[model samples]
Target: MDTLHIVCPACQTTNRVRNDQLGAHPDCGRCKQPLFQGRPVVLDEAAFERQRTRSELPLLVDFWAPWCGPCRMMAPAYEQAAALLEPHMRVAKLDTEQAQALAGRLNIRSIPTLALFVGGREVARQPGALTRADDIVRWARSQLATA
Candidate 1:
């Protein structure tokens, strides 16, 4: 059976999930939290690194700041996109205010940036607030297809 490496959103421990069991509401072996909760997982720098580098799933990271108006406006749309994208890809959010160093390392020049990472490398990035859920989903799917 093929297994996918998934990093626990709550515990940061990597869990090996069988492909056939992905839709069965898999739980983390360490923290026992549901793996795919149909919401974007919030990540700190270290946990972000683990999910991005260690997990086999494609990762879509939204780098945003609380004070940014565009970022705030895009929040709900991003969440909606998460619901549409999960099981195939993992969606996560990284606050620029909390992870300033990480934001700097990624050279994030805008208030809201959407980056697609596959196999630990950033494949594409969109530096703006995508307000529509369909737009976000389409853009992500296109990026992944090209990646």
Candidate 2:
């Protein structure tokens, strides 16, 4: 059977799940937390690295800072995009303030940047706050198609 590697949001454990079991709401082997929660997972640098490198699923990371107005404004739309995109793709958020070094390494020069990673490499990046859920979904799908 084909399998997909999914990183647990709660514990950052990489779980090997059969592709057929994705819709069954697979739980983490290490933490037993549901894998797809219909919301963006908050990731620190370590967890972020693990998920970005190990998971077979495409990872959509929202680079945001707590104090940025546009970032705060886009949070709800990002959450909605998570609801629509999960189980096929993984959506995560990294607080730029908390992951300062990681942000610098990624060369993030703006708030509310959206970067899509597939197979451990960044395939596309958009620097700005996206306020509409449909727009976010559309952009992600388009990028994945081209990727």
TM-scores for all candidates: the values are 0.97, 0.97
lDDT tens per residue, model 2, 1-147: 999988898988899999999888899999899999999999999999999998999999999999999999999999999999989999999999999999999999999999999999999999999999999999999999999
Model 1 lowest lDDT segment of ten: 30-39
lDDT of 1 by residue, 50-146 (tens): 9999999999999998899999999999999999998889999999999999999999999799999999999999999999999999999999999
What residue pairs are clashing in model 2?
Answer: none
Q: Where does model 1 exceed 4 Å of error?
A: none
Q: How far is candidate 2 from the true structure (C-alpha RMSD, Å)?
A: 0.7
Assess each prediction's global lDDT (C-alpha) against the native: 0.94, 0.95
lDDT score, candidate 2, position 65: 95
